[model samples]
Structures are given as C-alpha cells and as structure tokens.
Target: MANETMLQAFEWYLPADGHHWRRLQEEIPIFQKLGLTKVWLPPAFKGTGPNDVGYGVYDLFDLGEFDQNGTVLTKYGSKEDYLSLIQSLKEAGIMPLADVVLNHKASGDSKESFSVLRMDPANRQSPLSEPFEIEAWTAFTFPGRRDTYNDFKWHWYHFTGVDYDAKHDESGIYLILGDNKGWADQERIDNENGNFDYLMYDDLDFKHPEVVSHLKDWAKWFLDTSQAAGFRLDAVKHIDSEFMAEFIRYIRSDINPDFYVFGEYWKNDAAMTQDYLEQIDQSFSLVDVVLHMNFYDAGQKGSQFNLSAVLDGSLMQASPDLAVTFVDNHDSQRGQALESTVEEWFKPLAYALILLRQQGLPCIFYGDYYGISGDFAQQDFRELLDKLTFLRQHYVYGEQNDYFDHPNCIAWTCLGNEEHPDGLAVLLSNGDKGWKKINMGTLNQGKVFIDYLGNSTDEVTIGQDGWAEFPVEAGSVSAWVDRDSLVN
Candidate 1:
C-alpha cells in the first residue's frame, strides 16, 4: 500500500496574472509542513493564448519561453519560474508531478484546404456531410518558438481530424481520411460517440509513426527539462491505449525507469477504467473517476445516501493499488466541464475516508484547500484538511479493519505499528449521531483515545479487549487517536 499523499497545486479559477508558479514556490515549505509527499502541478507549457488555462495547448516546446500567442509567460508563469517551482518542491521534500496534455494540439498558425468527411457529433461513425474542401487551421509551425527545443512542425497530415472550418465558418467533426491515418480503434476506447479518440482541435494520429516518435521525444524533453518526478497524462481515454502503453514504456525505459505515470480516463464506470488499465498492460495508475462520482452522489443525496455502499462500483474498491482517489478536481469544480462538485458539508467526511484509509493514494485538490475565487469564495476546507493531513502522516498506517455495516454510518480502525506506536479509529455518519465499536488491536488495550478532530469532547478508555465505541456527530466524521501520542 502506498502511503504518500499528493496535493494538486493549481485550480481552474486561479488568477490569470501569470504568478501561480511564484506563489507555489513560496508555499513549498507550507506544503511540506502539511505532510504532502507529492505535488501535482498544472500544465507548464504555453496554451492557446496568455489567458488559456494550459489545456488548450498550442506549443509544447514553449514553456512560457517565447512571446507566443500574445504572451511571454503562460497563465501560470514563465519557463524559468516553472523550473524554479519544481526545484523548490524537491528541496522541500515534495516530488513534483507534471501534468502532460497529449490528446490534441490547438491554436494553429495557418489554415489549409483539405477534403474531409463530416461526422455526427453524437455518432462519429455516421457521416453528416460529404467529402468537401474547406480551409482548416491545421498548420502549426510555432514561429514564435523558433525551434528552441524541437523543430518538429505539425500539419493536417499529422492529424486524424478537425472540428471547425475557417472558410465556411462552420463547426462540425471532420474526419481527415487518407495516408492510412484515422481515428484510433473504437474497440480500445470509450464507447461514447462511436469513438472518443477525437477530442479537440487537430487530434494527433497515434497510428502515424512520426507522430508517436515526436510525442516520445517531447516526453523525454519535458522530463529532462522540468525534472518532474512523474507524469499526469491528460485524456487517456481519447488517445489509443496501445500508444499510451508504448509511451509509458518508452519514457520509463529511455528516460526514468522508476518514473510514475497515471492517466485521467474520466469514465464514471469502473469496468471501463479497468478495461483501459488492462489495455495499457497495467503500466500506470488512473484517477478513480467512479469513486469521485460516488462521492458526488453521496454529497448530493446527503443523509439519504447509503454510506455502506460508498465504495461500491468504485475503482478504489476494485483495484486499490492502481486508483488515485480524490474528492474533486479542476474539471469537477464550478464553471468547468465535468462539473460534479461534492457538497461542501460532506467534504470533511470525504477527506477523512480517502486520507486515513489504507487503500488508494489520496489527492487533495487546490480548489478544495484554498477556496475558489468569485462565486465559490466561501468554500475552503484547508483547516480540516490540515488536521487530516497531520493524522494521515502520523497515524494512518499498518493493517486496517473495516466496520462498514450501517447504511448511514460507517467506521474503521488502523492497527498500531511499531514505527507509529499508536493506531487510529475513524468514524463517519451521514444521517445522525452514531458510534461503532472497533478494535484498535490488543496493543492499544487500556489506552485512552480522543477524537483528534474535536468532534466529540468525551475521552474513551479502551477496555482490556482493545475495543472502544467511536462516536461522530450527525453528518460529520472524526478520527480518534491515542491521547498520549499527541504529547510525543
């Protein structure tokens, strides 16, 4: 079981003044103090423009290095600032996980006439328009970058499809056919729209050897330049699974053998995620989207939600080792796509489950830690998260025993270890005030325990049997640790 905790260092709503990397550098010490072992930084490359959130990738080689797309610095900061941020994180004993966007490239340099078959947005297999010539923005020379790192230029031949035509001012999915280049195999990807291989502007043709070679080179360059501990591959479901597996193998073998890699599949079905994992030869971990959806559903339903079934149909439950558990991410937060924000009241309980559990590596979102600006300014879980992080760092270890017997209340205990010396008892309730009797192991016999979260003021002395009733408030969660452990 991996015990390290990761913190997402950026949110979607962060100020676009291009100073995020500087701020992250300043907060490195604070992150270390919070017991975060790894920090996941947002995309460091220049996006479509100055205000782009780094997702609308224009130039992969330009990490805010040149004055491209009307900005010398990205939304986060300049290339120098990004490198400094990674160095600062390493110095603070936290590994930096770089966000890698490899699905598609956007913001072309010019337009070109091409014959394409328009496909239905709903059903990509079905054609909507006949093969017609139209001016599409598919040429990317990166003139501003001027061949700084890699001089590879992209054109329509390197892509599988496009979504817009500049001449007709039309918006539709156009399948770029010819030269044996097309969308990835439908059988290897999500079933949505026949095939989800084409996501945004100028989808890269993974079938093309040149495209794969260029991407691999870029990956090596990225790792060498940023010195990131690992990669967070974006939109894996939209890319070919075989290509991803090959990419991971190439990067790990040629660059960093022990490099960690995880992907964002973004499917609500655990089976789909598992299938993708199998397709990738289980080479990388995946964000547990199913678990996140469960959290969202539980938060929306509140007390009516069945707490006992919280882990059902979740990737964490099915494959804990390969699941990166999280409550909310940038895409799930307000004002973004895939918005399924967990209710504010259930955040503490959610964090307790993920952080204190033995299964799944927990990821703390920056939006949840530092409140979002604008409409969601009042929502901040930093204090609670701090407490949870402290408990996770100190007491979340050893073997675990679950007591998930109730529909609205559930509890578990982590047996004490020789290193930590004391164990933890966690209790949660979604309906009303409740308690569960859990064994903290025979080693904890006669020890006094109190809720570290202060949810309950009462102290419970463990009987000789080493079991005690842990109580939590209605619609809340608590972690009970040995009182003596606090002093040492």
Candidate 2:
C-alpha cells in the first residue's frame, strides 16, 4: 500500500443544510489535487433526527433512503448524493473512508416497560437506583425504513442499557439487568466508569450472537452499498476489542482483503492505546491521541513549551505504522465534548511535523484546512496544508534523521528516494528564531535549498560535507527542499 494521507472531511458544527455530500462531490477534484489519498467522510446514515450529526445513529440501513426522522435526507444530502460523492472520490483516485458508529444506537421508535437499575455515571459499576420497571425507549423497528435492507428489529433485549426514561421524564444511566443482560466485560475495556461499554442511548450488546450477526450483515451491506475503501470506527474504547478484531477480519474477508480500518481509541495514554492494539492483534490503526495531547499542550504553552519532548509518549515514536497522526479532530475542535483545541498558530508546525516525516499516516482535519463553523471560526490553512501535502506526496520518502536536540526548536531531514529526487529538511520553533546545522547525507552536496513553505525567502547552499545551517522564525516552521527540485 502507498503512504496515505487522509482528510477528515467534516466538522461537528457543519450546518445541517443537507449539502455536505454534494459539497464533497464538488471538491473531489480539488482534494485529489491536494494529494489527499483518502477522505474520511462523516456518517452518512440517518441520525436521531434530520438535524442530528449522524453520531447519534438511528438506522444504519437508512442512509437517507427512507422517509424517517422527520426528513428523508440527512445532515448530508440524500443517499444518491452520498453514493455519487463516494464514486467521484474513487474516480479521483481518493479512497472514501466511511465513519462507522457501532457502539450504540440512539432515537428508538417507542418505549417498553423493563426492569432497570440506575448506575452511577462516574462509576458505572455502582448502582444508584434499585431495580424498578420503567418505560424506556429501546424498541427500534425503523417504521419508515420498513424492511428495505435487513429487517433487524432492535428491542430492549438487544441492548445492555439506556440513558433516559420517558415515564419519569428524567435522565440517568440505567442498566438492563436480568437474564444475562449487563455491560460488556470490564476486564476487556477501559476502566472509566468501571466498564466504558455503555456510552449513550441503547448500547448494543456485542455478547449477543444475534446482535453481532446483524451488525456483521450491516457492515457488509454498508461496504457493498457505499463502496468505501475502509472505515473510521467511532468509540472503539467502549466496544469489545476482540469483537472489533473479528468484525474487521470478517468484513475484510467478505469485501476487499486490502480494506483498511482505523479507530478512535481516545486514550491519552500511549500504553493503553498500545494495549488495545495488542488486544485487537493489530487489526486496525488508532488515532494518535497521545500525540495530539502533546501538540495541544505545546500549543497552549506557546514559546515555553519543550520542543524536544513533542513526540514523547506518543504512538508515532513507538509504532508509526499503526499511528494515525492528526493535529485536530471533530471532538478536539472548540466547543465539542472532548475539546482540547490546538492553537491556530501552531497548526502549520504540527502539519509539517506530521506530513513531511516518513512516519505515521497523517490525517488533515477539515476544520483546519477549510476553516470551522459556528462560534469557533478558524482561519483557513489550505495553502499551508496544500504545500505540506504536496511535499508529502511527491518528496517525502527514504530514511529520516531527527535533530530533536534543541529545547525551543527541533529539526528533521528526510533523504529523498530514487523515485523522488532531492531531500527535505524541516525546521520548527516554538520560541526564538534559530538555525540548525543539519547534514543531508552527502547525497546532494553543493546544492541550494529553498523553503517550500515560503515562510523564509533566504536560501542556503550545502557544503562539501552535505551540511546546511537551516534557519526558521520563532513560533513557525519551514520545509527546505532542493532548489533544483523547485524548478518546475
């Protein structure tokens, strides 16, 4: 497989105008030109309602195909529009990575009386309310999508718990116990809330063979219907790792063997992420949340941040192959549930660090590239992202050398391959401006180098020993490519 760069093509604050899919279709050629190998599309399935962001998954089969949720179209456009967008992306040589939410299902059809015990939100193992019969909204018949795809009618038995009850008109975490019904195994999941299995609304019981079979069928159907290259699994830490591995294997075997899958583990600890990866037998890659946190800390601290320790305790440093590096995501964006937004000034440096390196697969967030919506209106980083992606596509290859010796500044060099002539030297600073004496490995001695990012206009000529003193401004990043390579 080729070194891939993915783009998270949607943000949480995207307007519910039902034109995202169409907009993606229109931007397919532009994304191809930007050298995006894959585009991680937002959930195309119908959400709790028409305006929902699709994370509150209602009907997996109903991808704007039926007249449900008060509207036939999703936040994105109709089913036909989504399929067309996927086809366009493929035609443009870009893989469409569908966002798959399988951990839970929300917005059920009706309420059913069931014996439930309220569990503490902080400690899910500790029950707060005694066993009592209450009318909970867990029945999902998909009345609007009546048997169009697979007729898997979800009931209270298919779920382990719910968060709300219509009878009391109150909100509390309730676990449906009795007859082998409970949360997933605590030993196999994150210790948060005892077991992090139950996230929101009707948490699907992966232990049930019938539920697993239905999900498997839906996965197959989704792949076949969308023709997506892979999936960006949502809330993997809350789901069973073993079940995830099996699902990935089953889908890969059933569909294309080369089908890729990555997940949002959302753990700040690299060890926990590594353990999850081990538990799943390395079936899927995970977003480098640890690295993102590091970037976030650095961005927040500004010039005082330690540049040398940027990659410390990061998955990219330990296992680059399975690390999906990203600067910001939907959850990490401003005003989201897991908001730890990276400062705008540090994004270019972050992008250069991830994109110009011969390491983890980098994902460009749409909020950064195209600017975000709502209260947090971000400045567009398209030009900077474009230059980095261009270098990544055409020049990033071969051996890498890390000059992470400076406290306020750090540098790295990538020796170019035969396919991509000339090397790349990257210099970043979170503090005062500085220069680093980097050796380009004598492959291009006496060659002139210029900053591809246009941050610096000065050029440096390599010495007989292939060493050049590269300078960058404070709180900025620069990528110096061979001057000869810059001549189109």
Candidate 3:
C-alpha cells in the first residue's frame, strides 16, 4: 500500500536536556505524536567536546549511554538509544533516517584540538599543518582580512564544525574563521599551497585509505545493527563530488540495497541542485520550495502564474523521484518577510501539493502539519501533529497519481488499491480575497466534492461552467479538492 504522508522530524529541534542518548528517550512521545513517518536523528557518534550539533564529530563509533535526566547524555546519544529509537519508530511504523556528517571532523581555531591532534610548533606551523588552497580571487575572510598566505602561512576550510586540510594525517590543525564555537573549535594548519580555497567548506581528504575504511564501517553498523532505512547526507557541496558518489555506492551495495540516500546540495537554483542529483543515489527533494516560491510570488505580486504552471513545467523540470519537496524548513519560515508562504488556509494546500504530486517522496516538517504556534513547547506541537496525521494516514498512503499537473490549478489525481483515480484538485489564490470560480477540468459535474480541512462542498453546475466560487483567504491554500474523474 502507498504509505501515509511521509513526515521527517528535524533532529536539531528534537528536545534534549544534556546529551543525545538521554534526549532520545524523552523524544519518543514527541515523534509518535508528530505523526512522522521517519525520525531523522543527529549524528549518533562522539563529537569534539562541548558541541551538540553533532556535525563536529570526533569518532564514528561511541554511541554512548544515557544520563539520569532523560536527555541525550552525550553529544547526541548512544548506540543503545539509537537502537531503541529505531525500534520505537518501527513499532509506530515510522522509518529512521540517520543524518550522516561524512564531510569533515572537529578541528577549528582552538588550542585543545591541536593538542588532541598532537601537532608541533604549538603556536606557529604545526608539523601537521598544510597551506590553504583555493582560487586567489576568492577571499577567505568576508571583510577582506589579510590572506592566510600573508597573515598566518597555513590554509584550510571549515564546515558545520569540522575542518579540512590536505597534506596532513588525522593529526593536523584545521583553520576556519567563521564557525559556531558552541559546536566547533579552530586551529592553524599550514597553507603554503592554495588548494583548499576552491573547495566548498573543507573537502576532506577522501583519498586516504583509512578515511574510506572508516566510512564503510560506519555504514555497516547503521544498516546491519540499527536497521536505518535511509540517510540525509549533510553538506554535499563541501565534499568532492566523486567522494559522495563512492560513498553512496558503498551504502547501497554493502548495506541494504533498498536503502535511500539524499544529500544537502544547498544550491537554490533548480539547475544547480540538479547537478548533484546524478552523483547521489537520491538527491534532496527541493522542488516543493520552488513551487511554493512561485505560488507565493504570484500571490504577493498578483501575477498570472498559477499552480498549473508550477506542476506542468517548473516542478517537472527536476526529476520528481529525487526531489525532496517541502514548503518551509529549518532555514525558511512561513510568513517571514523574505519568503512567507505560511498563511492559515494555505497549509493544507502546500501539503497537498507535495503528497498528491507524483514525484519525489513527500516529507512534511514537524511544525507545519500540526500547526505549532511557536518554535517551542513540545506538548502543543505533539497535539497538533496527532490531529493532522489522520489526513496523512487516510488520504495519502498508497495513492498513485494518473495526472498531477493542471492548467490553472495544481492537480494530484490519486488512486488507492482500487483502479479509479480519486483525490484532490487544488486551486490557490495569489493574494486575492474574493471567491474565484474554477473549472473542474476532467472532473464529473455535480459529483460530491468536499474540502477535507474545512469540510465544505458545492455541487458542480454544468451549463454555468461546472465550477464553484469560494472565498480564498489570502496567503493560504485550498490544499485538497475531492472528486472523481469526469467521463469523456
């Protein structure tokens, strides 16, 4: 059966008190209530000291035990907690996708890390330091600081919190100027050569045999023991494209062949995002944001573009199976001054756009579905998620689409195990408040039609154009319109 609406829980927001393991126990209820199909946990391994983001990793192993407070006792959580969480999610029929940070490791501007790596010259050029390498034009520091060639003598790059430096073993300093101190620490690495500059963030030296072995082992444990369904690779652009391809191949072949892998390419342009899709097993589904942006802009500007154009052209341009469609994520908020798609009525519309669309797997954010009032309060968010999960479970799961595009609307005609195509035809207003009449296209006239959320319906009148006019609250979406296909 087509599964229920796919939901992804953002790991960074998962409530944790001290460490990751402790928090995992506390977060089970939250995950269950959120109606998430998948729980995306932060990196479960040990990380550089005092960092909770989990990107600044220290060891691929070291999934530690929980503390007394029921929070993630360690940097994120322990292996036992991961096993428990995965089992819990499975019991609830939700899959677990481990967020893997394979790009780099903890080593930022700090004395302790250099001490850990055990580099020499303590203050100056550590025997392990390598010169930063990049194009001359690309400036390392934003406000035009002196080049490392002149200022320090070493070269490097940083991502999340991990640093990348060539010409050094595991024991070297990684120089990064801009980093979250809470998560990353910096150190000096020689940069007589300028190879690291052109690389995004810090491209880890994947050529090392040890680097390759470590990643393979990591994948083996996650797949063989924990039974993780997929992976969300962090910072793909920061790593060499070939490295990513090889990593994906390792996971797919060695691990479960059915396992899914999506990467964070982070390029805003669809074309740019597409460039990396060919390299990874499954690229991050980014088309929903594009559609959302188009609809949002049309609404705000009162333009002629509508949902149909988005479905027919823009969204299809990218491979749908690969795109991870979402309206708002960790970075984008609804109703923000920059790109506000978060209107009261439009919530369902956006969901429908994803779940009903015949493209990449549909994944919903935690807050958007349940209608969390704010970013805080786990209790409130859980309540909202439970209620909305019904729609996802009942209407979305196991539905196939015969057609998902529309001329003036976004249509996702879904069919369950049954043969007939039956689902929603969505119409969203571009900032207009008045009721707009819309044609049913190939839908039957006078068929019973209802808005799932509002629970209202009107009979289709044929001579008058087999349409109905309903008030469209501005900045919102009429996400679903239920009816059967019309007879030719």
Off by over 4 Å in 3: 11-15, 18-37, 49-51, 66-72, 75-77, 107-203, 280-317, 333-348, 369-422, 434-445, 455-473, 479-488
Output the TM-score of candidate 1. Answer: 0.98
- lDDT of candidate model 2 versus the reference: 0.89
Steric overlap count per candidate = 0, 0, 54
Instruction: Select the stronger candidate by lDDT from 2 and 3.
Output: 2
Model 2 clash number: 0
Q: Residue 226 in model 2: shift from native, Å?
A: 1.6
Better of 2 and 3 by TM-score: 2
- lDDT tens string, model 2, 265-314? 99999788889989999988999999999999999999888999999988
Compute each candidate's TM-score over C-alphas: 0.98, 0.98, 0.65
lDDT of each: 0.89, 0.89, 0.48
Q: Predicted candidate 2: what Cα RMSD to the true structure?
A: 1.2
In candidate 2, list every pair of residues with a backbone clash.
none
Return whichever of 1 and 3 wins on lDDT.
1
Q: Give a tens-digit lDDT track for model 3, residues 1-488.
A: 44434555542454444444554556667656645566666666545443455665544444544221122344554567668877777777777887777766543232222211222324322334343432211112311222311222112322212233333433233443332211111111112232221222333445445456656766786577778888877766555666567777777777677776666554445554555455444434433445556545554444355544554334434677666666554444543323444443344555556654556666666556444444532222333334345444444533443332433333343433353334444444444443455554344345555554453344333223445543444444443445343221
